[model samples]
Target chain A: MIIDVSDPADPRLADFVGLRDAQLRRSEDRFIAEGLKIIERAFAAGAPPRSLLLQPRWLDGVLPLLTRFPDVPVYVGTEAMIEEVSGFHVHRGALGSFDRPAEATWEALLGARRLLVCEEIVDHANIGAIMRVAAGLGWDGVLVSPGSADPLYRRAIKSSMGASLELPWRRMGGAADLARLREAGFTVVASTISPRAVDVDAFEAPEKVALLLGTEGAGLSREWLAAAGAHVRIPMTDRVDSLNVATAAAILAHSLRQRG
Target chain B: MIIDVSDPADPRLADFVGLRDAQLRRSEDRFIAEGLKIIERAFAAGAPPRSLLLQPRWLDGVLPLLTRFPDVPVYVGTEAMIEEVSGFHVHRGALGSFDRPAEATWEALLGARRLLVCEEIVDHANIGAIMRVAAGLGWDGVLVSPGSADPLYRRAIKSSMGASLELPWRRMGGAADLARLREAGFTVVASTISPRAVDVDAFEAPEKVALLLGTEGAGLSREWLAAAGAHVRIPMTDRVDSLNVATAAAILAHSLRQRG
Candidate 1:
């Protein structure tokens, strides 16, 4: 179904209305996948597309993929009209709304050997980068705390390069969730900058590991740190306070990932 | 030298005009530091302050520092006034213009053991993050290609958490500059995603290392990669295309930094 949309107020474009409004997007069930690359990744990851709003020039690029989803509406509009509907300049002139996939089940996450557990990391870019690092490094899954930014957020998905769509991840409830990982034979490792923590290079990773990363400003909560089976810190010079959470995740994830 | 300015167009505020305009800022001799922390970092790094524009409330916090630079102008104003002059909402109600520090001398950089070499990495935040990772991990200095983003750009400095101020970095003319690192006893290591590249963990870093980072979209130019003494890659699953350049820098920097 190819629809020509000239009016930005068209009700059919509801999923993309105010795309830049994070709060509004959170209240909706659909997540917008921006750019042709992310859209293709979303499709490849088996995410069902609700509809697509894109400039006519991108039609040839996405036409093959649309053949598989004959029922999904494909709205073609001028660049200005599309930007008006989204409330922002849509990058590369393509966007797709997909049904937000269900979170990975606890049973699946528990069986995993390597996992990243994030606590209150509110930055969508950080959360997305963590997911990308986790997935790229062959980590089994990610478990984000309740307060953490949604990995499915448009910006997060874009930042993750669509890794969030393909990776297995679930929302974690609270500090008590540490017990669940422990019961599943995971040694919960807390990443801290405190000198008291064991240096990451010297610490031996266990057979099953769940690395705990904290927020951007203050590190992991004392309660969360106490619950960990071990504490690991990346040694750094005193010139700076700490590494960005995403940067830290990349270093930690690469170091502790299962090696052949 | 405390001064009150209600008008955004005051002639005295020329250095602070359009702080958000990268092109305009690049043409000027001064760079803006957004937050009080970055401003303080700029001062501590021994970079002379040209001027300070901040809200009235932050006066107490920066007063101690201003005492040291008695000749430097301090302009206090409403947040709205500051935002109007900057063309953006200045973060944290504070901003500073600092004399852009000179590039590190080749003699100084030649003495360093660990270095990050960036090639045309144009994103300001990536350049900033790379600087932060290099500084935090205790790298001696950074060498960026002439086309790379300015490490002293306001957004770069903010993303770096002022690491750009603290780290010693220089710009290189072209691919011929690889010979300079070689002559300085650095084994230039090119980072790539190819399977043919040596695994980062398995590869033994040379005594003096200059790790090469490429642009955001492309990995590295053929000439640069071919010029490298060795190629190393952080082993990753094939699911994702590549890590963000800064994230890759963190993993490679920590892995290759001199260990005690």
Candidate 2:
């Protein structure tokens, strides 16, 4: 079903309310997928939709995808009412509430050859972009630090172009996870700007590698840098402080791609 | 000069008004640099300062740099007043107005071994991020299509972390510029996700190369693609449609970096 809706304050529209409030949405159990494309991506990734709030114009396009989920409510409304309920301009007049998938297990990641370990790379867009890069470059998985931004956040998922839904990723428990990964025969290489760091292009590719990346502020923690098998730096012209986290991640992901 | 201004609409503060109106600022002869760090970067880049609008807290920090341009106005006010003047929340209570520097000449870019030619990459942040990547990866210079976003836009400059000011970049007159670049002995490589494109890692890079990038919405125009010496693509898995334009640029720049 397509159920009609006019009242912005309708109790059924609670999930769509204040969609712009990142803080409010963060503590919720379900993640919101905005726009027709992302909503479709969520469905493709087997994310069960709790409900969908959209305008009548989008009903025909979305109906085919909802065939498997007959129980999920499809709340149709006027553009004005949808905006009123969302408390923000929803992109392309569609939003889907989906059950957040369970975190990917370390065992699943351990079976892979290449991975990205993010240390406090907490910007939502950056995290999302990294996931997109990882997925595109065919990195096996990603592990975000405890303090990193939620990859499931709406903007992050959107920024990742729905890769967050498909990529195998989870919150890394702590720095100790690094030790365990190393013990499992994965070489941990940190991406740093330290002058003594080996140039990534010049470094030898290992059989199994975990590329460690850090935030631009403090860089990889001194402790984490020391624990890594090697520190690799992308050579620069000394004009910029550092590349944006996501940009740097893409370069590293490309450099460390698992060649067939 | 420390000039206290409490009113946002004061005629003397005309250069700093409505900083959020990107179109209005773009038409003017100067560009706005938001945040104290960018303001410092602007000075360090040797961009002439027209004026400065900042809160009193930043006065001491800015005064040392303004000794050479003692005549440039320094307007100080409360944070609230500064926000009002900017028509947005000013970054760390500072914004600098600098004379837009002259564009880099084709001859200057022709001398470089590695360059980037952006085709309608209109997003300011993407433009800035690409500049930062180019600067970091040692790309000699950048040439943007006529419709591309201004690298000196406030957000672009901030996104670039001031690399927009330091990096050698200029806008090309039209598609004819590409033909001219080819005549200048630069291999024009188009970056596309087209299936027929050669993988960047597999494609042999030329000694003098100008990588062509397109907008994410549409790949490079047929004319540009046809003109390219080679069409190279970064290998991607099936998860994401394509990498973000900036992310893709970084990968390509790193892959085709000018090695010493």
Give me the candidate number with maximum lDDT: 1
Tens digits of per-residue lDDT, candidate 1, A129-202, equal 99898888899999999888888989999999999999999988888889999999999999999999998888
lDDT of each: 0.91, 0.89
Clashing pairs in 2: none
How well is each residue in A189-234 modelled by candidate 2, as lDDT tens digits?
9999888989888898798999999998789998789889988988
Q: What is the C-alpha DockQ of each candidate? A: 0.89, 0.87
Question: Which portions of model 1 show Cα errors greater than 4 Å?
Answer: none
| Whole-structure CA lDDT of model 1 | 0.91
| TM-scores of all candidate predictions against the true structure | 0.96, 0.95
Candidate 1 has which clashing residue pairs, if any?
none
Q: B29-119 in candidate 2: lDDT tens per residue?
A: 9988888899999999999999999888898889999999989999999999988877888768888899999988878989888998999
What are the runs in model 2 whose C-alpha is more than 4 Å off? A18-27, A77-88
Relative to the unseen true structure, what is the C-alpha lDDT of residue B69 in candidate 1, on a scale of 0 to 100?
Answer: 85
What lDDT is reached at residue A115 by model 2? 92
